[model samples]
Target: QEHGVSGMFTAPTAIRLLMGYGTEPAKPFDLHTLTRVFSAGEVLNPAAWEWMQKQLFHDRVPVVDHMWQTETGGPVFANPYGVSLLPIKPGGAGIPLPGIYAEIRTPEGAALPQGEKGIVVLTRPFPGLTPTIWADPAYIPHRLNGQSLNYQPPP
Candidate 1:
């Protein structure tokens, strides 16, 4: 890289778009300075992740997928590349970050097993979670009345 950029954070849609251009367009650039790649906003499909890992970077860097929400403030599930390098799992939004109490549960509040489809719920409030949604005073009571904020993970 001309400017020695070390990392990149992008959306999966951008990666898929770049993938359509193929690997040839990337050959002219020296990307050795890049150390890691991050994806958010949407689920990163295995096919797109594979192309970025094997074809684009040739396994030189880890293409990490993470997920967050505006309500939660920052990333709740991530690879923690800065802490420890975990094994890359294509299409997975890595393990929960430290201090984040997260679990997948059924509609009736029963915890779901691993690999099961359910809503993602935060058992406790974490730092940075907005106490109230701005300009929506009525919605705050409903959200904070022991009601789980349901986030259905992609199938």
Candidate 2:
């Protein structure tokens, strides 16, 4: 486009909103400089992924979906497009990044088999994981203890 932006990171809701405008609005700009797109914050629904891949970017760039949290400090699951571009599985957050061990487990901490709903647990820590919240050392443990946790299918 105007700035010759090569990469973009965005939220799924933003993509969905753009989808509502259709493709015509973007026809006037050249998006060739764009190489890839990254989405996080919420589930990147398959419909939005498809529209961005097929209608917006014309399949020229990879649309990657990833997952992380403020507490995690970085992406836990992501398609490592910079390393090896994996096949896009619509609506899925890609595999755990290297050195980050993650599993879907029950509240009791037993690992759950694939396709079973369970809470995502990090079996080991990574450098990027936040060990403590600034000035709130006890917040994480307290909040976790009080919550009745559940899990849904992976985005």
Candidate 3:
């Protein structure tokens, strides 16, 4: 509240702690300065999400959850804030980022139908992903197999 931070992306644990502390000890600090809150790393429990939306911010701010990895460098699935304000799903991650060819594939490399859970794979290349995490591509065995592959954007 003191720093006037308008946005943040953090784990559910930290968000919960801050919310809990803000209400304790008689006076609640004003958190209206925060505009957007993004949660990742751990699941945002239903109870916490409800409390944050209903009790904490009074539905003024948006609490978003996205899924990504260090290899991807940014959110692969997230609510597009600037492009469009999509409906916020309580426990579901938002849609895939534009231009990303995301699919759920089985071990045999077959694409799974919607609502089925499988290994998430990128069938197309996007910027931000590094060509190699280590000195050699040999370090990534999954890249050699059909089950998984790395996306290298065309030069």
Candidate 4:
């Protein structure tokens, strides 16, 4: 029953499914062998995180919540390893990693600041990112088309 999966990157929905199937805490499982737990493809709910924090990662093992999209290319935002994790919010996308710029955008290409809900957009590209799409360097401006949503002036 031991799979070679020290790293499990899955959605909260799938984690819930595992819990539904009766996957219990791991003071029993080799927590030492398990180094990291990554959640993505959906928001990580508070209850699920609490299970990991209390039951799963009591040793403070790493957990990364990747925020990404295909439009801006690969994951423009992510929780890098090695940094200490903070108390996770119930439904918050934990703050972006260092040296990266990301913002939510609206329909008309205006940028929205932190805590605002708009189209998540990256101001600059990140490591392992393709500068342009499909071998077209000049095609980037159109590709990274901005929008206006939350960061609008009072009207």
Off by over 4 Å in 4: 1-6, 22-28, 70-73, 83-87, 97-100, 125-155
lDDT of 4: 0.60
Between 1 and 4, whose TM-score is larger?
Answer: 1
Which stretches in model 1 have alpha-carbon errors above 4 Å?
Answer: 130-155
Summarize candidate 2's per-residue lDDT along 1-155 as a digit string, tens digits.
Answer: 77999999999999999998999999998889999999999889999999999989889999999999888888989998888999999999999887577899998999999989999998765547655434445534553354522222122
lDDT of each: 0.83, 0.84, 0.74, 0.60
Residue-wise lDDT of candidate 4 within 1-155, one digit each (tens)? 17745777778887777666443644466646567787876677777766665555674666566666555454444555556656545555577665356778997779877667787666755433655434555443443345311122123
Q: Residue pairs in steric clash, candidate 4?
A: 106-148, 106-149, 107-148, 108-148, 109-147, 109-148, 110-147, 110-148
Q: Write the per-residue lDDT of candidate 1 for residues 20-110, one digit (tens) a residue.
A: 8999999999998999999898889999999999999989999999989777788999899998989988988899886578899999999
Ten-residue stretch with the least lDDT total in model 2 = 146-155
- Using lDDT as the yardstick, the better of models 2 and 4 is 2
Candidate 2 residue pairs that clash: none
Prediction 3 global C-alpha lDDT: 0.74
Q: Each model's number of backbone clashes?
A: 1, 0, 0, 8
Model 2 collision count: 0
**Regions of model 3 farther than 4 Å from truth:** 16-27, 131-155
lDDT per residue (tens digit) for residues 1-155 in model 3? 89998997888887678667654542466777799888886667777777777677779899888877778888788888767879988877789886467899998899999999899898766544755544455434544344434433223
